[model samples]
Target: MKVIIAEKPSVAKNIADALKIKSKKDGYFEGEGYFITWAFGHLLQLYDAKDYDSKMARWKMENFPFIPEQFQYKVKSDPRNRDRQDGGAAKQLRTIKSLIKKREVDGIISACDFDREGQIIGDTIIENINAGKRVYRLLLNEWTPNAILQGLNQLKSNEELLPLRNAGVSRQWADWVIGINLTSAATLKFQKGKGQALNIGRVLLPTLKIIYDRDKEIENFKPEKFFKLAALFRTKDGKEYEGFYTEGKEDKFKTKEYLDNISGQLNGAPAIVDDKTTEKKRELPPYLFNLSNLQGYITSKYKGWTSSKVLKTAQSLYEKKYITYPRTASNVLDDSLTGKAAKVLEVMKKGLPFEEEVRFRKSKRVFNSAKVDSHSAIMPTYLVPKSLTRDEAIVYEAVKNRFIMQFMPAAEHEETKIITKLRNADMKGFFVSKGRVQLTEGWKKVENIKSKEALLPSVNVNDEVETVKNKVSSHETKPPKPHTEKTLLKVMETCGRSYNEEDTTAEAMEAVLSGFSIGTPATRAETIKKLTDTGYISALGKNLQCTDLGRRLVETFPVKELFDLEFTGRLEKSLADIEKQKFDKERFLQLIYQFTKEAVQQIKTGEDVIIHEIASSKRSTEVLGKCPVCGNGVIEGFKGFGCSNWKNGCKFVVWKNDKFLATLRKKPTKTMVKQLLTKGSANVKGLTSKKGNKFNAILKYEKNPENDYFSWKMEFDKKF
Candidate 1:
């Protein structure tokens, strides 16, 4: 008998159904010489700080930087609820262990998801069970029977997968080390007597720093005024054309007088066409959708669509066989897919107009063995899903069409540039105008190119056109845009390329790796979403904005490198090296140790004060006003504007983002909450309504006698 372990119960059932092993047992399927069981995602977790030592439980300063001599692992069951563990992961592990120890069992097959985390789950259980059976891995990507069967045919030795497991272990330890040490250090050192936990991490801190920096930039920006010159001319057919006055840096005029002076010169000075240049240009189809690219594309195009949504939709499409694996970093396919290329294209082009045009052929741009890692880029498989939801259909069309466009020809266009010269009583100068005439729609037929550049009418070099009208336009330089879901993902994806260092150690290391990113493509979106859910950031429409809590944490944190982009990039690159089996795991952990020690030491000595967070605190100095119900000091906190009697069961607290003020772009501040508590209402100005009209209203805090959890509520003076 061979025991196969899968990541999830659903996946295990799918594998059993595919292999015809239908005899169901308590926690596994049996019969046909195989016993298949599954883990509920990850059934084990790394040992917490308290598990290493009892002293670490109270989160005291004396037990700072709790770096374990050797890290430990534990079952994923809650410590407080240890008695009930047998029916859960404990039971499943025992079942698998019994199978592994079976006299007839020859070997164990790891049918976990073919990723770092998945590999760790298999490695963890197998090591704990200590079942000396021959271990082999089932490297499955998609859930299809063909994919699984193909994977089963080519089993890899357990030793071959250790590097990936080592990398995963290193990552888990690094995160735990920093999280436990710094969270305690920062919370104890700054937060002092307050019971609030100041959670920190390797990737989470740096990600918050990005939003903080952007918010600061937006806040400190000073808009500058400038002017540009434009000329309006008439064609022989009486059609009007507007051309920008291009003169390099000299184009923008600081003074309106200078622009008007230039405008006066070229108004009606018998201008003759000095040059007319038209060159044919071609725009190749866009690269295929990887996770980040897909997230960026979908988020930008679809208003309500988020990166998480895109990932889920793509994963669903993959399971349904409408598309290939979605959680990949590569945008190009591997040479291995060449055998089924024709059938895949046939299925993709079934009901599309470009069926005859998408001929399958080996192109370096589309398919290359060198560009891909273990997984191929997201593309269509041989199976086409017929009935898809509206969102599914949108994503399906995007991935499929992106693949289809690769086979079609490039988009062709005729770019034209016309220059006119004027010299008379008014001053002398040349004005240039340009446009593009799309000769061939090509790939644009399937892809939405919006609209091609405008086409300019044919004109000779010496032909004179009348100066119909002209004006000088005044403009102001806009501030840097708040990170949209589209831009933030791109930055996070490529941010590992640069960092501040004299020796330039990590940057040099990152140069060897292909794609250096802050977080893995699979988890970047989740990190951003986590930041938002935790109130570190907020989304207005599609734009990501840093909230007060997020900004404050980034600003208050003492260790700058903890939030440094370069450090993150280098660390990520180091992980990639570990994955590639090029970097030493022991050496990487040593570096993490050194960094953590220094960071904790700095926090101990450094005097940057932590927020006087009143969350679960008995008292606070940053009190705004007297609480109406409890007559205690109403204090400002990370999550809400609350009363100092919060520890004594006072529930008169208004959430920072009380639902009443969330849509109005108003985060409840100390002042706002104070007024609601003391005066029964707080008058707010410039509150943007749902229809986008700005209005003012008085916000009042009210408590209900009916509910226990949701006792505090806010009501506005007006209906809106």
Candidate 2:
């Protein structure tokens, strides 16, 4: 009997169904010559810092940067654990182990998702059980019966996948080392007795830092007034178009002097067409979809959709066999799959509008072996889907249409550039205009898109014309816009570098470089979700907003390396090298270890930002008047000021950290708290109300909680 282990139970079931395995056992399916079982994602994981040495369990400054001599793996322990430690992972492992030990089992097949993490999941179980049986890797990108059978026939030996396994192990260990050490150290030092864990990770910190940086940009932005000049001219055919007046090389000016001088030059002046140039141009179709590009595309087209949602929809399409592997990082297909790609195109274009336009022709833009990586680019599977949801159809059509457009002809266009000039002696004005006319709808025909041309009226070189209109408009330098999931995903994919879908830079494929990105294509969505779930980022509408805590975390953390994109990029580059067998694993481990050690040491000696920020809450006045209830002195505190005898149950307290004040985006001041206790009322300004309107109101103390406790009540009475 041969045993095959898959990533999840659903995948295992799919494999069994494809093989026509009928006999269902307790934890696996049995038939003809196979026994198939599955892992619930990951059945094993690296142990925690304290798990190695119980003394290190309680997080303290001295025990940080805890580098274990040998990282150990065990059954995944979950907080949702039941009678056993690892929820269901322990049971699943035992079932697989028992199967591997059977006398009839001659070999074990690693039929996991075929990624590094997938291989680690299956191998971890086998390694722990000391299974001496021969292990083979069955690489399957899809669960179709034909694909499964083909994978089985071309199974790879374990030795062939050593580089991937080593890379996987290194990533796990590196993440654990940094996450465990830095999180504990920062929490212990900054939070002190506050009990808040500042969760840090290899990828999470940099991700959080990204949102924080944007928030800072918005906060520090200063709006400056600027001016733009435009001249509207009428051509001989009575067509009118606006061209901006340019002064030397400056189009936008800080002062009105340049605008006044330039607009005056063309004021009622005869406009002459100095030059007119037109050229025929052709635009090739975009490259195939990778996970990031696909996510960016979906979110951009459908505003409300996010990267996480796109991945899910794509995964559903993959499972339905309507598309190829969805988690791929490659945008190019292997040259060997040219025939297969042709077949996909033929099947996908059955009822497509421009079916006749799409012919079987291979281009370097679509098929390149060097560009192909672990899996082929996302595309159709030669199975035209009929019953798909709206979202699924959107993504499916995107992938299929992109693939179909690749083999089609280039989009042809007639681009025109016209230069208009005024004044030869008194003053001068040079204006330029551009327009594009679609000569042929090539790939655009298949995409069902028409190019909108900025048509210009017929004009001759040096022909005189009249200025129809002139305007000097005022504008301000605007702050950078907040990050939409589309933009943020691109930023993450490009390692915080500015990247566009059309960018063909060498850094485009630099996914493995540390300075490029922190997480893999398979894990970026989760990292984004984690930022939202942890309150590090707030999804306001379709854009990400950084919260107060998020800002505080970024500003307070002294270990700047954790937040730097270049640092993570370098580390990622090292990991990629590990996969390529170009770098030593020990050196990579040392780099992470040293980084953790320095961070821990810095945190230990560093002053606590949490404690400092809390106690250092900027108060309007240092000390308020005496406590009315206790006749004792009252001073300002982080939350509020209270009678010095509060320890003696005076209860004469004024809370600075009031929920009501927070709702109004206001914080209590020593003077406000003092005046309430001494004079029964105080005048406060700029208080935000429920409807988001700002108003001034008179605040009064009611002394509502009448008991032994001297609790003061606040009320806003007179509003202005």
Which residue pairs in model 2 clash with each other? Answer: 513-573, 514-568, 514-569, 514-570, 514-572, 514-573, 515-569, 515-570, 639-656
Q: Among all windows of ten consecutive residues in candidate 1, which has the lowest summed lDDT?
A: 496-505
Which lDDT values do the candidates have, in the order given? 0.76, 0.78
lDDT of 1 by residue, 1-720 (tens): 899998888778778877888789999999778899999877878777787788776867778877899887777854434423424777788888898999999999998767778889998998889988899998865777777777878999978998889888888889889888998888787764454477777888888888778878999999899988788877666666667765652567688897688777665656777788888988778776677778888898986788988988887776564677787776677887887766777766777676676677778877876767557778877666769988898898888788888877788888888887664535444677889777877788786565557857767888878887788988998988888877787667768343311112444323423446777777888888777766678888777888777777787788899788888878887887898888989999999999999999989998768643644544347778887677989887666777788756677777776644766777776667667766877777888876799887776666555454443343556554
TM-score: model 1 vs. ground truth: 0.84
Q: lDDT value for candidate 2?
A: 0.78
- For model 2, residues 1-720, the per-residue Cα lDDT tens digits are 899988877778778888898788878999878999988888888887777999896766677679999989878876433223664777888899899899999999998777779878878888998989999999877777778888888989977888888888889898888888887777676664443367778899888888788878998999999998888988777788778766576678788777877776666778789889999998988888889889988887885677888998998887776777788778888898898888777877788677787789877878888777678788888777778888898998899888888978899999888888874635455787778889888988776797788887888898888887788999999998888777777777778665576565666665523325768888888888878665577765567888777887788888888889988877877777788899888888988898888888888887656721232234444457777777877876544676776655577776755545655667778668767767878788898866788887777655545444433344566534
**Model 1 misplaced stretches (Cα beyond 4 Å):** 78-87, 192-196, 248-250, 319-321, 389-391, 425-428, 496-515, 615-691, 694-720
Q: What is the TM-score of each candidate against the true structure?
A: 0.84, 0.81
Point to the candidate with the largest TM-score. 1
